[model samples]
Target: MTKDLFGRHRAVLPDWLALYYEDPLEITHGEGRHVWDAAGNKYLDFFGGILTTMTAHALPEVTKAVSEQAGRIIHSSTLYLNRPMVELAERVAHVSGIPDARVFFTTSGTEANDTALLLATAHRRSNTILAMRNSYHGRSFSAVGITGNRGWSPTSLTPLQTLYVHGGVRTRGPYAHLDDRAFIDACVADLEDLLGHTRAPAALIAEPVQGVGGFTSPPDGLYAAFREVLHERGILWIADEVQTGWGRTGEHFWGWQAHGRSGPPDIVTFAKGIGNGMSIGGVIARAEIMNCLDANSISTFGGTQVTMAAGLANLSYLLEHDLQGNARRVGGLLIERLRGVAAQVPHVREVRGRGLMIGVELTRPGTDEAAPEAASTVLEEARAGGLLIGKGGGHSTSVLRIAPPMSLTVAEAEEGAAILDRALRSI
Candidate 1:
């Protein structure tokens, strides 16, 4: 049955849509932090559907909220007052740390970022945009324009003029050998140089951590320094927090807080995780920028009743249980455990990340060349050992991405780590 379904999926889906493993397992159901394949074999979930499942699977609060909302009313569009949407927006704005923040809901991170780009270009009257190298924003035409990773970005034609910046990854860039302060200074200098050669860009968009580029991050305070320069030139900073939002990073509620010295960005885009499993995404911006458009617009399905209800319930559960704190504690231990395991593996290049968003980059022993085959081996072996993980990286897809639900328990972490340890040793 699984083989038949896999064949059918390949027949219907785009070829570019990649799947993991040599033989993909069809996930039949999930509960807590575990999922079962069609063959009735269960595996501990580490990727959480690419970090979309923030809380545990089948969380009662979220299920109840979805069921209740669906029974009441599912779709009304944005024509009328949406109580749940308003409530969720208020909560998100309060937590977003942006002053006079206005929220606009969308169906996905791509749409959220598209809306942000629209706002930024309209407000600043420029089409040029600055983005960090090794960043993945989304897959839409507008979002893809700003994406800096070559593998994920397939098109050269783009509506916006995008200029790639330096310093998204600290491990293998031109300034890799420099100290943290020196690296930040070098990136800032590069940004200054780029600005000198082109028209002032509408905004500078960046991820606090480059997710699909292998959970890599710049030196702390790097963006803060760049913000100082952008602020003087009236350039908006857009923080793409699709994968790093909702306290996944542990120390900060939002990933951009790692560079908090410069205060909040002018605009922020978020999706994944916040809705639990619901399709919810949105952009938060200052009122002036959000209101820049003269004509009216509305997303026919954005801020629908059902998704908002799920979002409200899921968010309430996240805050009430303090899952962020749990991510910090459990994720810290998990990283330490993986680091210890990686220490014994010659092919493991580096173990990096914060909270549950950890990455183990694979490389040829004693060389900088990426070992993507080694990553695939570890992924398959770990799955065979009753663990499900993910692989990602711009440089040949050689990074093992491990981001479990924020509600992950210490025992589960230990179990997953042990399985991963064996998988790494096998590789």
Candidate 2:
């Protein structure tokens, strides 16, 4: 492929655009778990387009559905109802076990999250929101405000008094000194104290499995406890399953199920794998909460025909094949293999997460310190060896996030792990 002429000193690119620090590669094509760069170099996609693409690239069924829908009707204004829209919403509600829930679709995760927040605030007539430290909602202003990552922006804080909950600590790497149980207790205490001292919050949002926050799965019964506390105060629980939803975590159709929680969330936002690769997102909220807001309050493009078709196709494929079962089996094998690799590689501090949503945290020699440099080196070497992964977390950038498609086979899992093991050895 020709060198991009757009990489010049004089360009009309927007000044606000901040490219990812890594050198960009021009990907020309993709298939299941693999993509070819413009130069024809193939890379195994363990990252799965940042943990989206649940079924894989150019899936025949999904493509056929999109094609047929495109041919029939691509766009329908909100003034009229569409079949795909109604069908997808019904399917999602059925699968999620929230029969009375209603869906408000959007084109991306951020928009979905933003809509949820708006609805929550409007319904409760409350100004404050609660979120977990290291949780990632989205990039939009309201969503980013609740995101606890300090890396977002120096001034990016919640407009309301956002309460940051502490679930656990690294105990090694970036959070070496922080204790997990103690931190959780402190957080719970803080929440109780705040509730007793002040007015109730509009909502308390959390990722069932914190994605950008090191893929940390909180202690058992933690989410249930959170739900209990929030419900007591008449506050809504919003599960931001942007990364953990759509059967990626295995053991269940949703990550909240993996938490062993009993009650359902008042509001659940989904994106990423919902449309497989096509852009679509939505909020599934309790009928009561949904009814509090006027229909005219939200604008157009919330439920376009093309996105609804893709979402329907994606959900149908997942259900028909029982891909969640695949995620459980393959994810179990992946964790076992990764743990074995961790035993051999001293730099590997911990292997955490459920099912396909996994993170390998790295540490430095002699000290229980995060080796960001080593993590970067391993990522670079892995890319050189034709494997693709991502780095995330608070301080370390030491978490190697592995979230492949739900359809990734056992053989593919083994091969990907072996290649990653080789890359770790080099580090």
Candidate 3:
């Protein structure tokens, strides 16, 4: 059955679309933190569908809300008033931290980011953008153009003139040898130098925790320092929170809070995890920036009744349960366990991240050479042991990404870590 499905998929789907594992398993269904394959094999879900399942699999509140809303209506274009959409927007605006925030919903992170680009370019009257090195924004033409990661970017032709900046990867760049303070200072100085060489940019967009760039990030307060510089130049700051939003990081409600010493960002984009599995993405900005477009615009299926209902329900459940606090407690334990495991493995280059979003980079034993094969071996071993994980990096995808549901229990963390420890040992 699996072979037949694979054949059919290959015949129809785009070849560029990537899948995990030597033999990709078809996940049939899930509950809480576990999922069953088509062959009746069950495994613990750690990647959470690329971290989209923020709360849990088959969460009751989101399930019920989706069902009831579907019974009433699935969509009614953006022409009419949408109560659920309005409610979700209001909630997002209130929590966005941006004063006088206005929300615009989309169906995916790509579209949300595209909308942000439109706002920034139109408002600032500049097509230039500042994007961090080793960043992956999305797959859209405009997004790919701004992305600095070569593996993910298929074309250099873009609608915007993008300048790659330093500081995304803390340990692999020219400033890797510097301490935290010097690293931040060198990056800030680079930004200042880069700006002097180019025309004034519309905005500087970045991920607080770069999801596809091996879950890497600059030191805390780095962005705040950059914010100070950008503000002096009248540039807007856009935070792409698609993966780092909704308390996944544990220490703060939003990833940008780690750099909030300056102030709130001018705009924020979010998707993945907010709706638990529902297709929900959105952009929140100050009313002035959000309204800069004089012409009319609307998304055919964005903020439809059903997705909004699911998002609203999921958000409520997350807040009521204090999943952020749970993430803080359980994620800390999981990281410590994984750190201990890494110490025993020669190929484990670095273990980093915050809260539930952790990464384990693999390198050739006793060297800096990225060990993509070692990562693959550990991944296969973990799957055989009934555990699921993910891999990503700029250097041949040698980093293991572990992001379980924010509501993960301590026992589940221990169980997942044990399986991972054995998998790493097998390598």
Candidate 4:
């Protein structure tokens, strides 16, 4: 059944849509942190459906909320006021930290970011954008314009002008050998130089932690320093928290708070996990900027009743159970275990990231050459060992990405780490 479905998917879906594993998988059902495939094989889920399952698989609270909301009403569009939508917006704004925050909902992260770009350009009257290198925003035309990852970028044609910046990755760059303070200083200097040379950009968008670029990260407070410069010039700052938001990073509710010296970003776009698989995304901005557009705008299916209900329930559960703390405790142990195993493996070049978002970058022994084949081998081996993981990286996709649900347990972490250890050894 899985093989037939895989064949059908390839025949109909876009070729660019990639799938994992050699045999592929069809998940039939899930409970807690585990999922059963079509063949009735249970596996520890480490990817969490690309981190969209923020809470857990089949969380009862979210499920009940969605079912109840769906039974009453599902779609009313943005033409009318939605109680659940307004409720979720109030909750998100209260936590977003933007001054006089206003929330705009969208169906996905791509659209949420599109809305942010529109707001920035309209507010500042400039089309130029500054984005960090090795970043992946989305797949939309406007989003691809700002994307710095070459593999994910499909074309160069875009409506907006985009300039790439450095400092997203600290491992392999011109300033990799520098200390943390020096590195931040150099990056700030580079930003200053870029601004002096180019037309004034509308805003600078970045992921506090580069998600699709193999979970790479910059030094703490790098963006706070950048914020100091941009704020002086009236340039807006947009934090793409699609992957790092809602306490996934463990230390802060929003990833941008890692650079919290300057307060929150001008605009923040989030998705991936907020709805707990219900397909909800939105943008938050200061009311002044959010109201800058002359014409009205609305996402046709943005804040529907069912999805908002799921989001509200999921968010309540996240805070009530303190999943952020759980992520910190379990993810710390998981990273330590993986690092210990990587120490014995020659191909493991670096283990990086924080909290539940961890990355293991592979390279050829004694060289910096990326080993994508090694990553694939480890992925297949892990699946064979009853563990499901993910792979991502801009430089040849050689980084193993491990971002599980925030509710991950220590026992599951240990089991997944053991499987990864054996897989790395096998390769």
Predictions: Cα RMSD each: 0.7, 2.6, 0.6, 0.7
lDDT of 1: 0.95
- Each model's C-alpha lDDT? 0.95, 0.80, 0.94, 0.94
TM-score of each: 0.99, 0.93, 0.99, 0.99
Please report how far candidate 3 places residue 255 from its true position, in Å: 0.5
Give the Cα-based TM-score of candidate 2 against the true structure: 0.93
Instruction: Give per-residue CA lDDT, model 1, range 1-427, as digits (tens).
Output: 8889989999999998888888988898999999999999999999999999899899999999999999999999999999999999999999999999999999999999999999999999999999999989999988888888988899989999999999999988899999999999999999999999999999999999999999999999999999999999999999999999999999899999999898999999999999988999999999999999999898899899999999999999999999999999999999999999999999999999999999999999999999999999999999999999998897879999999999999999999999999999997
- Model 3 worst lDDT window (10 residues): 388-397
Q: Put down candidate 3 lDDT per residue, 1-427, tens digits, no spaces.
A: 9989998999999999898888988999999999999999999999999999999999999999999999999999899999999999999999889999999999989888999999999999999999999998898999999988889999989989999899999999899999999999999999999999999999999999988889999999999999999999999999999999999999999999999999899999999999898899999999999999999888898999999999999999999999999999999999999999999999998999999999999999999999999999999999999899998898779999999989899999999999999999998
Clashes of 1: 0
lDDT of predicted model 4: 0.94
Candidate number with the higher lDDT (1 or 2): 1
The pairs that clash in candidate 4 are none
Weakest ten-residue segment in model 2 by summed lDDT? 1-10
Cα lDDT of model 2 by residue, 1-427, tens digit: 2345337412767655544225556667889888998779998888887788888888888888889989998887677867888898888888775649888888888998888898899899997898877778888767778888776534555566687766634342333454665545555676788788777899988888878777986665667777788888789988888998888888767777754465778889989898887888888998988778765654367677887888888788888998889999999999999899989998988898888999998888566687888888888888888888888877657788898888989998998899899989988
Once model 4 is optimally superposed onto the true structure by TM-score, how far is the C-alpha of residue 99 displaced, in angstroms? 1.6
